[model samples]
Target: MALQRKDQDILNAMSLVESTKGELQKLRDNGWDSLMNKVSSFCEKHNAEMLVMEDVFVDPRKPRRKTNITNLHHYKVNCFYTILDLQLQEFNDRFTEVNTDLLICMASLSPLDSFCEFDKEKLVKLVKFYPDDFSYGETLCFEQHLDIYIDNVRRDERFKNLKSLGDLSCLMVKTQKHLAHPLVYRLLKMVLTLPVATASVERCFSAMKLVKTTTRNRIGDQFLSDCLVCYIEKELLDSVTNEKVIERFQMLNERRVVL
Candidate 1:
């Protein structure tokens, strides 16, 4: 969000606009090569130590007595390349050509760094990218808003140092100035709603340890979901004492049990 995506796009476009994708691909290829080289160096440095298997001195036919039966080869091929391949596939899937362009355009609405990095051209591309979402009049009106928004944001200290799009949305609401930049604020709201990262969702998996286990793995999906909700919000659950919990359980269907 702090990047000048418009300027970067324009700078890339300077060398024949059609070549930008090619250049980006080249950079990706170079990055992949660099990663492979690093992995190769690490493997070479530790090949003997990592790939060596323990000696098994007995034949399979004689393994009925004291013997170490082993089928693993000493020359183990690491699956680091497979991991890199999957990561590349995931990246390509999520960041198709059109999606990359859309994201670059969306960066125009970012409120980080006092809005000094906002670009009208990228904002215009964003409007054009989704014609149905934004009308012609609204996009045209955005030009006026863009200038006023930059001036207003630069002058106002309240708009500075926003950590994320969520912060930006809250600042917009707090200032009560959505009317000043309706299109930008709308885009801001949309960006705020986007699931940029899965850290919050990923945290739930850590919380899952509290409920699901080998001995109690028959939890239904709905029940597991309820458990996760409770697990994730432990601070609130901690506030409810044993008495309150017992009361709630007793209240379920006319006193189900006494805790």
Candidate 2:
């Protein structure tokens, strides 16, 4: 939910992920007693029978094995530890070392809080990921530009108290600062395109369900792509008027009739 906020940025998102991992680890290590107490309270309130920790745990469907196991082992090891371990593993799998570093590097470029998070070293490292976007010559130039860009934006009143990357990008363009620091703006553009969370992807899938219904199941890939683009980017599409679209369509080929 923190990651899904409208104003959430890469810096905040990265911090949230890191903090969540730490909290989950702490739970796995020291939360058993606390968790058990809550569960016990809930069970007692609901009139559910609470099993004795020392009692032998019996498998309802399977035949009893020769080896004895207490309810403590069954719940603590198989249920508690197992679930926590799986969650920690999932976090590790999703936010691997490289991915975490990438996020950190990207966060360094954030314009929030007067660009307090800006790090020239991380920005340089970030560009390496996209060699196609930042060539050898451009990369060197970007390092030089970063020094000037950071200094300028930090001192500039227009860049102060910025909320998100989108605001920074817009302000840069509005002030014509993007033209002054082309490489920095280019890197910013690339960073903006990277997906920090699954919210947009989930929205796309939800929109797809509505778009490609049974009646429209046979739609071609190209047509589907066009429809999805317009549907997903409705805000941008809304600005365009029917007459403007007709004018552009007519301009595509010379029309015989003026009307």
Best by lDDT: 2
Measured on C-alpha atoms, candidate 2 has an lDDT of 0.86
Q: Write the per-residue lDDT of candidate 1 for residues 38-70, one digit (tens) a residue.
A: 656898898833322445444457656654433
TM-score per prediction, in order, is: 0.51, 0.71
Return the TM-score for candidate 1, rounded to 2 decimals.
0.51
**Per-residue CA lDDT of candidate 2, range 51-165, in tens?**
8999888777775664388889988999999998998899899888888888889888887778888899999999899898777999887888899999999989988988877
Clashing pairs in 2: none
Supply candidate 2's per-residue lDDT for 254.
Answer: 87
Q: How far does residue 221 in candidate 1 sit from its true spot (Å)?
A: 13
User: CA shift at 104, candidate 2, in angstroms?
Assistant: 2.7
